[model samples]
Target: MHRKALLTLLKEHHPVTADEKAMTQATIEFVEANPACFERTLLIGHITASALIVSPDRQQVVLIHHRKLDRWLQPGGHADGDPDSRAVAFREAEEETGLTSLKLVSPAILDVDIHPIPARGDVPEHLHYDIRFLFEADPTEPFKLNEEVKDVQWVALNTITTRTNSVSVLRMVQKIN
Candidate 1:
């Protein structure tokens, strides 16, 4: 779960897009070049873990209305020095959605994204090298809202495109098998 581990995953993953390929390489370089890459102390950018969680039957996905970004996104958060991205993904999913029955569909990296986090308070704008994994949540379990999101819902997989225009969500949807 350390930087080395993430770097290894990046090097081995077969990225689907040119952007993803570039981002994967960039993340590997970043992890090697910056000792603080695993820690949030890296002001310019840092590693984050996320989960593209789907219902047990794979008919729907769980999305949160992110409070800071005002966007509906999969559950994820800063690693906060945690080397285990898989654990981070699981922890964040449960914390954000209150669904403890979730299980990782696979530990492999499903997606890699580098996005900017707008400045907040004294923290200047920074990039998040988000590492995403596929997960499945028990359809029978209910979820409760957390502080990070205004609301949480299970949206139909087929209707995700109409509900939101997020490429990450759409991309993950297509990859869900």
Candidate 2:
């Protein structure tokens, strides 16, 4: 049931924004069309999972200064061979930020994004059909930095609004608010 939660969200919720509507439809279509989409070996495009981790009080979000992208973004990565998107999100969050106490806000997807990733090493440019899930992490917990990101910090919600400008990121924020 890789798509059960996501299909439920798209079918039940009337998205407020055009971006949300489009992304939801796209995700449904993509999943319905390709059963092997969970594999990163699918060069055409693959499912990338991301975790939008917010503080328990909902005032701040944890973002990583992605070493590759050179920008502040949520903690996430490719699904590899995993068919479970939620598991992918949690694993990536822990691996990227070392937050063992992180908890998922919900099993349902918070957002879906389709973005192009530039070629890295021998990998060709491809689309990342990112399925994002909301999560909560302790603001007081000491974060252990990893090689995946240059820096990690808790950012105020307003700062995310002003800086990230990503539709999916903002939508995740809206989900909590």
TM-scores for the candidates: 0.95, 0.88
User: lDDT scores for all predictions?
Assistant: 0.86, 0.82
Task: Put down candidate 1 lDDT per residue, 96-120, tens digits, no spaces.
Answer: 9999888889879999888889999
User: How many clashing residue pairs appear in each of the predictions shown?
Assistant: 2, 0
Per-residue accuracy of model 2 over 119-161 as CA lDDT, tens digit each? 9898899888888888998898888888878988999997786
Best by TM-score: 1
| Full-model lDDT, candidate 2 | 0.82
Cα lDDT, model 1, residue 79 = 91
Q: How far is candidate 2 from the true structure (C-alpha RMSD, Å)?
A: 2.1
Top candidate when judged by lDDT against the true structure: 1
TM for candidate 2 is 0.88
